[model samples]
Target: MKKIIVSILLIFFIVGCGLKQTIKDTAQDLTNNTVALIDDAIDEITHESESWQATLQELSDNLTDEAQSTIRNEVQNLATRTIAAAGSEIRCNVDFLGARVVQALQRIKAELLNKPIPQRNPAICQVIPTAIDMNLTPNRRNKVDISGYDFDNQPLKLYLITNDNQRTDVTHAINRLSHYHLVLNLGSNGVLLNETSSRLVLEYKDSQMSSIAITQPVTPDCKEEEISFSPDIITYMPTHTRGDRDYGGHGPAITARVNIYVDNNTIKAKIYMRARETKSDWSTADGSGVFTIYTAPSKRRILTIVSDKETSTNYIDSGHAEDFFEKGSGELVKRFAFVGDTDGDEAGTRTRVKVTFNRVVVKLKEIGNCKE
Candidate 1:
């Protein structure tokens, strides 16, 4: 029975993998809003069965007629085979199959969007390709680097989960070359310090989850800093834009607002970004993540911020920026920018986007002990 199940799964897995790549390639041609719409339609299908066909039609509108027909046929055929296989030894219903198929499709969609996925069973983990000969070591600048085969080729998220299940995002720390590698800058604000136990987690395509225990402690030079900013909310608008195409220019202007909270050595930011490609079309990028803020004068502030996976939309990726006190306003400000290669590099359709930060209202400021 297990063999049968595995065999059936293998068949579906192959199909799913192929379909995943095809859909992802197709998605590259779609605008961000269009892709979000398709994603919402898929989300709708998972919950309601009666209107799936109609929703599927909406999805098909963006795809080629041939591709749409092929997807429809594939779904029907896969459903039929699942039912046939179930009849021999088990029971299956359309509702169950519908839910499962939608879940699988959603997973694929998440991967394409470079978003994190919900936790599922370990069996599903087998299909995801993993790193080989991987070695992770602490490097200078309060960062860690993981190197090995197949390490940095695709979009992935990394985290440091403490024993109590607190997760810290460290995904923006990567070196993107012909052969990808990781350069994790775990800031010196002692955010990663004092964890009783922690492990580095990696989430890749299809939510392939892999983890390595942090057997060796990372005891960076410690320090405490007193920093407080007011208005609690800072609004960021695009200060400059350079790309083959302009984002949020077609309809609404793109904007990001961050609600910030400061603790001893860490900064908690709830970030919300409105990425509107057009007036009638828009999608949100929102999530909360922590930042390790190291004070100046040996307090190195490396602003690599990633959001919480569970609550953030996949579109709201990590922000790589700098945090500093504005010389004139004395406001604690964060400046960051991101790039969008709406089309591949060979096509030369790259957009280097920049956004502006508002003046910070500093209420309190202090520096704590710095240990070497």
Candidate 2:
């Protein structure tokens, strides 16, 4: 009897492991399919029609709450462990597993339903130098080399930008400066007196790259390098006076602002809504439901919370922007946007908030600190 019971327990353990694996595989398939669907639907969602509303509703219903809960729990556990173990720098765990679900239903409801949508500008600037390093001795002539791919050499200008917002044009003063090199006259009388404090601004046509610092070949006291992300804070306000549909029919002009930032290794997004004409209709009809963030491609949901009432912060498990500095690509952060909806501040008032801009990029910042 003892032998038989032990054999049965072993069999059960094997079967249980197999079942767990099957669930993860199924969830991953769901995640991949959802990402493809959202990528294809982004352009189509802009079209004004009722069919979009119905389609989005069906998509939302199909993504049952149980599945999302399961994925979220699994992801949260992994994120916690990964964040705890990550040294050197804290990195948001990349969602190798398909878990985040994009809330397309909220976006569709906000943009459609008889609301005037805002015009989004996707035009971004490209052509920037990848490397800006200078070799120089204090108070002497220095050689600065700037190189990048697909650089338009015609009509290039180099300027010196100081800490107190001063710009000095030194394009003509530099001798033997070519498409990739610049001979800067350093020191008190020359362009740059302090190598560590000042920066070099490179311009090609209308494209510009700012905050190009100098790096020394040798340093006696080198502190730890500081890492930071560019465009530390992003604030967006609607350019048009268009309003969204509410329970009381057409409402006054709606003004919306979205703020996206990364603080303490956590990525956060928040929205502030108010009447353009009058500061009313600040909250949504759903009480604690106002904004949602989805991951790109898969449209996996990252965060959803009550906007204007509270702040929504999420771990960088999924939908976090990375690969900020890429060659050939323009200066754009390709990530997800916050889609919001709310009722007027007054009872019986409902309004929709729509945002079309959803691109984010990441740059790994490494600024050296030297002891004077």
Candidate 3:
């Protein structure tokens, strides 16, 4: 009975130890499984978040490109509309005033072409009358008698009448009257007439037509090298007998004038002869003329002469006048020139006589301080 009890106790101890080992193994297995499952779940969530962030970035880029394109198109449309409106305004303004200006210019051109060349004679000096009044009321016969005096204060006559009570008629008369070539200007509600030649000038003011007289003088304001603002001067030269006898005999004397006011200051003065009442021609000696320009203070003279044939000469006598100024200084002095033609080749066929009588204005420099 003692051996049986000891064997039973040993078996009980062995069974208890086996049971504890099994429980420990089972608990370790469960913990390992739980840790693996949590790691897998975290990986899946990270991948999904990355995909969502990439999609959102792509959508933002597309929206930015579309918005920029729309803004560019809208700006272009606004600019096009603004330019179109500006062009329309300019076109409309031009269309409204273009016709009237054109008509006025045409009328002036026609009147200038129709004007008569005055006959040059001592007794038959041309006369221009001024100070005529016009009545604006339609169909009313209001006539203004225009009269004036010649340069010698001789009585002159001119008729002033309105035709058909039309504005065009008045404009036509004004155009015709201004073509007379006389200087008729207004000063303090009165007319100032510069009548020193045969050319008559008529002026129109307040719808009234007036006239100014021009005459030739025996002796004019003469200066050897005087600066003049008139741009013209007249002189007389005696004719000579030379060359072949078969050629027509020249006149006893040649009366001529120099017109310096030609197309601004770019052109030189034109030299013309008045042999008879209506005869005039270029100098036979061609371009054998001298122009001496002088500046003030220094009074230095710059001499320019045309020594070639008229046709071959590059200098045109119809442009801006020359200027005289101090070097490096904007100072203007009274400027003047001596213009004349000299005779070359004594044979009458190509007689070279001195030709002088043209003049022009001189340009001056502005005043300024000297640079140190």
Candidate 4:
């Protein structure tokens, strides 16, 4: 029994010692594992802080860049405006400074926006061609005159003078005239004309002459008369009576009044007859012809006489003068003429004549007169 007890105690002691060693080993392993886990957590926190700091730096840099870009762009726009205002009068070192400042601002702004700055080109803002003003007048007959002045207020060119019959091409006229003026700035600041740029005037001498002297004289006629004597010797005698017989035969005089119109594309005039006349007395007037005088409407001024004949005549007369600007209507005065019996003659032997005037100026608010 003693032996058995001793053996049991030994076994107990050995087992306890083994268990303490096992427990100590397990405690050391657990402590090492905990330290390792704590080290990993600290490293993770440090790395995360570094990443946040880097991100913040990047965001600040971007913000600064954006602000700088905005400022630069604003400066560049201001400079551009200033340079534009300087116009052609800008001179000296101040202009250079202004240009440089503008360039620098634009460059900075472009850099921030990752774009290339465009270089300034002299041709971009060059004043090419120039400006011109033209005035026109009438000549011996009411004529269309073209004249021009340059930007320096100097006379530039006389492009063309033409009559637009509303049938002929106006493009040809414009092309012919364009040779005289330089096309510049899309023609906005060039080629100006006055309201009376084109005009027609009429002048006449002895307009009120009632009759014209005939170059050839009429033949005189004598009638034979039978004479009877009351005395015993009665003789039949031929009495010769010599006198100029009335061979007055006047044909209807035809006249035409013309009106000239100048517009963007269409140039036209209205024509009307003054009166209709019928020939009478075939013995005096060989043929009975209806004479018509086509007069222009009052709205259109008489530009020129298309024809003037004993049978038909057109007289371009500046019988009256009026201004468009003065009237505030921007229209011109047109004249016309008509013929009728002035003195009422029972035999329709006399004719009367008069003129009717009108206004024919185009409004300036129209567009697209010429197109290709």
lDDT top scorer: 1
Instruction: Give the alpha carbon lDDT tens digit for every residue of 37-120 in model 4.
Output: 323333433445323223223322432322132332344444444444333433213434334333443443343334566543
For every model shown, the clashing-pair count is: 4, 22, 29, 16
For this target, which candidate reaches the highest TM-score against the unseen true structure?
1
lDDT of 4 at 200: 17
> Which window of ten consecutive residues has the lowest lDDT sum in model 4?
229-238
Q: Estimated TM-score per prediction?
A: 0.21, 0.20, 0.15, 0.15
Q: lDDT per prediction?
A: 0.42, 0.36, 0.27, 0.28
After TM-score superposition, the amount by which residue 60's alpha carbon in candidate 4 deviates from its true location, in angstroms, is: 26
Question: Residue 240 deviation, candidate 3, in Å?
Answer: 13
Per-residue CA lDDT of candidate 1, range 125-243, in tens?
12111321113432332544443223424666767677789887767643443122344445554225343546667677537456655554444555434333232333332222233
Estimate the Cα RMSD of every predicted model relative to the unseen true structure. Answer: 37.7, 42.9, 41.6, 35.3
> lDDT (0-100) at residue 312 of candidate 3?
12
Scored by lDDT, model 3 comes in at: 0.27
lDDT of 3 by residue, 65-163 (tens): 221222223234333422332242222232222222223223322222333323211121122232322122312212222221111222222222223
TM-score of 2: 0.20
Higher-scoring candidate on lDDT, 1 or 3: 1
Clashing pairs in 1: 143-184, 243-351, 251-278, 251-279
